[model samples]
Every structure is written in structure tokens, then in C-alpha cells.
Target: MKITEGYMPYLNYQTYYRIVGDITKPALVLLHGGPGSTHNYFELLDSLASDDYCIVMYDQLGCGNSYVEGHPELWTPETWVNELIALRKHLNLTKVHLLGQSWGGMLALDYILHYSPTGIESLILSSTLSSASLWASEQHRMIRFMSEVDQRAIEIAERTGNYESEDYIIANTHFMHAHCAGVYEIGKAPDCLTRPKKTGKEAYLYGWGPNEYTPTGSLAGFEVTD
Candidate 1:
């Protein structure tokens, strides 16, 4: 039940991470979604901490509690892949299981396909879409399910390229809470919202757009399915 927090320097940035449970046990690394999301969403996985597994969670560069400086162009998939490798080596973990949700899964696959890390023992992809095209399709479907007024407003907003409109943001947030988390709860716990910030908000907006479903950022053209 021991928890430790630390930082690992990688390339031009540093990753903030937490290790929970017995270090002597099998290691399980959890990767959170959002090229910008913090590890706070996976707090539930801490329950898995025990003698059987050592859970490791981290905020990637430009997100959560990780180092947020240096180069913005370095936020590509390849950089993230190398960051994970660096963290593994820093922790001295020989072999371990990987669990990634959404973008995390994408990064995990990128690592597996490219670097072929020697210590990976298993992988778990949860609530993750394999490709940006598939995610876009799903998002369209979700938009269609929205109220007629909301749908029209969103359509017009996108058509006019007015993504910054208050109406568009409000409608988008509504759809996100309803269809994304599948949890309608309004307020997050004080501690939940009070967690340390990771990366610059601009990094996420520049990389993944305003939300997961809306792919209007640098990753808009990103897709992987074979």
C-alpha cells in the first residue's frame, strides 16, 4: 500500500509518475487518454494495488503533472513512445503489463509497432478506438443522437468554423458528459478537481482539439487501422 511520486527526465521533457503497491510484484503501467489528459481519471485503478501487482501511472509530457516545457513540436507520437521507454528504463522494470485508454492505447500500439520494447508482457486497451476515422464516425453517431436543436447548432457552428462559440462549447460539453463518461454526475470531488496540473492547456488544444470527439487539431489526420 505504499505510494511514491517522482519525475523521470526524457529527451527534452520530464514525466511525472506515481508507483503504488509492492514493488516486488508484477508491474502494471496505466496510460490515460487525451494527448492532454492527466492520470487523475485512472485513480480507480489504484484499487488494484496489492502484493500481486505494482501499478504505475503517469502524466505524459504536456499533461497532468508532467514537465511542460521545451519544444511544442516534440509532442508527436514518436516522442511519447520514447518517453514511455525512458520511464520504463528509469524505473528499472524488466517486464510489465500495459493498460492504455483512448490516446494512451494509440501510444501503446505505436510503441509496440516501432520500438518493440523487450519487457512488455501484456497489453490492455480499454474504451479505445483503433483509428481516428473510427472515432470520428462514432462521434458523428453520437452527435446525431443529440437533440435536434443541439445537432443543428453544432452543424452550423462547424460549418461556419466557429468552434469557439459559447453555444458550440456548451453543446459539446453536454454530449461529452452524456456519452463520453457515461456518468451524468455534475460536480467532481474537491480533491479530484484540485489535483496538480500537468501540461499546458494549449498543448492539448493544439494536439487533440477541444474534445475527443471533435478532431480539429494536429491529430485530425491521424489514423491507424490494419
Candidate 2:
């Protein structure tokens, strides 16, 4: 199918967006994860192009083609939600189906709760954490299944805030492989799992803290599920 791409201007920054399939069909707007994650990994959405769904994907202001980096203070969920509104208006999206993943889901929830905007057909939240506390608890629960070495590495990393260490990375990778989508017992990290994702450190550090188990960023507080 035909793919259309453009930069939508928002608050002195340009959000890079791409559309697959016909605009006449039901529009499905996909919001990516991370205060830092790019939209590249959502390639699976392309199939929806032929299924009568207008698949839209975009990298938020601080990532991918937009690359409006170095402004961590400005990376608030409100700012991102505003950008989403801008993009919707720019594209003249009257009726939309919003699908957000992880932090993207958090942003979507924030927008609905704050603005209560209409015209959304549905909201699909994938692998989202309702709150930082919930995320931490889940990570801790998952760690119990790991080996002693991996568990030690993860524990030490969390204790010392040394997520950058090689041991921490290895341990984190193993944990991610198991819980980040793996189905087998262990040692079955898929190619997609092994691949490195494009993430902005400034956005992550300012928005999500030093690591996954910790919550010391702008979004440190707030309860979504509770």
C-alpha cells in the first residue's frame, strides 16, 4: 500500500509521522513506548494497512526522525499529549482508534483522564504499567524465576543504581527475554528481543528514572490502577 510521511509541527518541535493504507479507512493511531522509544519496532502494524485500517506511527519529539533531543525538562506527558492532539488536528482525524504501548499507554490514559476528549473509537493499551510502584513490584516478581547469578546482578544494579554496568545489562537482558515477551522456560531470547531499541537517555532519565526497577523521574508519582 501507499505510505505517506511528514513532520507535524508542535511546540517548536516537529513530530515525524507516517501513515500506511488509505486515509478513507478507519484510522488507527499507534503511540510508541518509552519517554524515549522510537516507533520503528511497530512494523507489525503495516499489515493493518490492507485490512481497512489506516495505520499511523510516529516518533515522539525527542526520538527517531524528530530527534528534538537535549530538552529533558520539556519531556512531560502533558507535552506529549499536546503533541498528539496537534498531530490529530493536523491530519484532520475526526474519528480515531488510539493504540498505545507501555509509556505510550500511560500518555493515552493521561489524555483521556485530563481532557475527556471524544471521537476515540477505542484505546488499546499494550504491556503498560498502571504506575511506577506496580511496575517495580512486577519486575521484582519476575526476578524470582531467574538464576542466582542474574538475580544477584539485578539486585546489585538496583541497589547501587549501576544499571550501566555490564553485569546489569546481562542480567537485565535475561530478565527482559523472559518477561518482555518470551514464552519458553529460559535462554530463548528472540531476535526482536535481542535487538537493541532506539531509546533517548535524556527522555528516559528525566521521565522514567535510572532503570526499570526504579522510579525517580518526573513520572515517579501517580496511581493509575489504584
Cα lDDT, all candidates: 0.78, 0.81
User: Candidate 1: what lDDT?
Assistant: 0.78
Candidate 1 lDDT score at position 62: 85
Candidate 1: count of backbone clashes, pairs at least 3 residues apart or interchain: 3
| Per-residue lDDT of candidate 2, residues 1-226 (tens digit) | 8999898878887889989988777789999888888888776668777756789899887877777667877777777889899888898887899999988898888887788887899999998867788788878887888999989998898788778889888888887677674555445644433455556778878888776767788888746775
TM-scores of the candidates are: 0.87, 0.85
Quote model 1's TM-score.
0.87
lDDT minimum window of 10 residues, candidate 2: 185-194
1-226 per-residue lDDT for model 1 (tens digits) = 7899899987656789999987667799998888878888677777788877899998888877774754667667777788888888898878789999988898888788767688789999987766777788788888998988788878878788777787887888788788775553445654554556664566667767766667776667676677
Candidate number of the best lDDT: 2
Q: Ten consecutive residues with minimal summed lDDT in candidate 1?
A: 184-193
Off by over 4 Å in 1: 67-71, 182-200
Off by over 4 Å in 2: 50-52, 181-198
